[model samples]
Target: MINLALLIFLVVLFTQIVSWVGKTVLQEVAFAVYSRVFLSGTASKQRQLRKQVLAEKAELGWTSSQDEFAKWAKLRRKLDKGIADLEKINTTLTSSKTSFSVKFNSLLWILMTGSQLFLVWWYRKQPIFWLPQGWVPKPVAWILSFPSAPLGSVSSGAWGAVCKRVLQSVEEIVKAILEPTVVPNGPFPTAPFPAQSQSQPSAKIEPITLEHEKLD
Candidate 1:
C-alpha cells in the first residue's frame, strides 16, 4: 500500500511544477497569437505613443495637456472595450465564466501534473523524490533539494499575479472615471479693461478771473 502522506506530498509538488510550466508556456503562446492577430505592426507604435503621451503630460503639466489626455483616454477606453468584447466572445464559445483559452490551459496543466504524480506513485511509496548524490547538474540538484519549499513559493507567485491584475484593473477604472475631469475648460472671450493705478487723483486746475473786472 502507498503511504498516504507521501502521495499527498508528491501530488502537491508535481502540481506546482505543472502550474509553473503551464503558465510560462501559455504566456509565450498567448503573446505570439495576440501580437500576430491583433497587434501586428502596431505594438511598437502603441508603445511609442504611450511614451510620447506621458512625456507631453509631464512636460506641460496636467492642466495644460487636457486635449491630448482626452485623446489618449478615449483610445484607452476603446482598447478596454475591445478586450471586454473579446472576453465576452470567449466566454460564450467556451460556455465558461472565463476565456476558453484559460480553461483549456488549466485542464492541460491538471492532466500533465496528474500523470507525473501517477508515475511517482507507481515507482515509489516514499513521500519525496530522493536524489542520488554524485555529479548532477547544479540547477537540477538545487530544485530537487527543495521541492517542498518551491511549492510554497509557487503559491506565493500565484497570489502575486492575482494582486497585480487586481491593481491594474483598479487603476484602469480610476483612470476612466477621472479622464473627463481633466479636460481644459473652453477659452472665453474677455474685454480688455485698462488697469487702474493706485496713485492719488490729480487736483483740478481753476483759472483765476478776479483781476479783469476791477481793471476795466
Candidate 2:
C-alpha cells in the first residue's frame, strides 16, 4: 500500500509536468505559426501594394508643361487622390490583418484548452501516488489526503483557467503593443481603425511624373 501510494504520487506529478510542457509548446508553436503564415503574409501583401503605388507615381512626370501651374495642380490632385486610394487599400488590409490575428489567437486558446482537457481525461483513470492509502489509519490517511485533494484540485483548475485567460490577455497585449499610438479614427469613438499604424507619414512629398497615369 505504501509503495502503491508512492507510485500514484509519481504518476500525478508526471501528468502535471506533461500538462505544463504541453501548454508551453502549444502556445509558442501557435504564435509562431500564426505570425509566419497569416501575419507575415498580410504585411507582405500590403508592402507589395505600397511599392506598386510608388512605382506608378514614379512613372507620372511632366515632359512638356502646356499649363505649368494647371498641370501642377492637376498632378497634385491626382497625387492626393492616389494617396487617398492607397490609404483606403491600406486600411482594408490592416483591418483584415487584425481580424485574422484575433481569430488566430482565439483559436490557439481553444486548441490549448482542448489539448489539456484531453490529457486530463486520459490520465483520469490513473491513480495519483501522493494520495493517502486507504489501509492506513484514518487520521494519517486523512492528513495525507488533505494536501493532495485541495492542492491538486486547485492547481489543476487554476492551470486550466490560467491557460485560457493568459492566451486572451496575450492577444489584448499584442494589440496594445502593435496598435498605433495615434488614433486615426479621431478623438471620439466612432469606428475602429482599419490597421495598425506602423510608420508616420513623411513631412515632404517627393514629386514624380508617370507617362500614362491610370486610376484604379
Candidate 3:
C-alpha cells in the first residue's frame, strides 16, 4: 500500500514538472522566432536602405560623366524597389507572428488547466495521513488532504491571464518594429552651373593703304 501511494505521488509530481517545462519551452520558442525572423529582418532591410542612400549621396559628389549619372539612377531605382518589397514582407511577417503568439499562449493555458485538474484528481485518490480527533466527514477529509490542488488551479488561472497579457504586449512590439517610418522626401540640390568663357576675341582690323592705291 505504501509503495502504491509513493508511485501515485511520483506520477503526479512528474506530470506537473513536465507541464511546466512545456509551457516554458513554448514561450521561448515563440519569442525566438519573432526576434530572429520578423524583427531582425525588418531592421536589416532598413539598414541596407540607409547605407544605399549614403553611398548614392557620396557618388553624386564625385560623378562627372553621364555614364556615372546613369549608373547612380539605376542603383537608386533598385534600392527603392528593395525597400518596397521589404515593406510588404514585413507586413506579412508581423501578421504571422501575432497569430503564432496567440495560438501558443492559448495552448499553454489549456495545458496548464488540464494538468492542474489531473493533479487534483490524483491527489484526492491518495489516503489522508492526519485527521482531527473528533468525527470528521470523509468528504471533508478528502478536500483537506490536498490543499495544493485548489491553490494550483488558482495559480494556473492567474498564470494564464498573465500569459495572455504578455502575448498581447509581444504583438504590439512586433507591430511597432515592423512598421516602417515614413521618411519625407527631401528636395534634391540643383546641379552646379557650367563654367563661363574667360577670354574675349580681338576686334577685326581693316587695311587703309589698299583704298589709296586704287584711287591713284
Candidate number with the higher TM-score (1 or 2) = 2
TM-score of each: 0.23, 0.36, 0.36
Instruction: Candidate 3: list runs displaced more than 4 Å.
Output: 1-26, 31-69, 118-142, 145-216
Single out the weakest 10-residue window by summed lDDT for candidate 3: 151-160
- Expressed as tens digits, the lDDT of each residue in 1-216 for candidate 3 is 555334434444444555546766866677777667657866677567667656765665566547587876766676577667667766766776677778877765555555545544555434323444445565554344444433212222233333445555666788799999987699877877755443455667987675545664
Across 1-216, the per-residue lDDT of candidate 2 in tens digits comes to 454334333444444444655745655666667657756865676677677667546644542345576766666677677677678767876676567667765765555445455544544433343433345566654443342343222223333444456555666787799997875765766766555444555467788876886888
Per-prediction RMSD in angstroms? 25.3, 31.0, 31.0
Minimal lDDT window, size 10, model 1: 151-160
TM-score, candidate 1, is: 0.23
Which residue pairs come into collision in candidate 1?
Answer: none
**What is candidate 3's CA lDDT for residue 20?**
44
RMSD of 2: 31.0
Give Cα-based local distance difference scores for all models: 0.51, 0.54, 0.57
Model 2 misplaced regions, further than 4 Å: 1-45, 52-67, 117-216
What's the count of clashing pairs in each model shown? 0, 11, 0
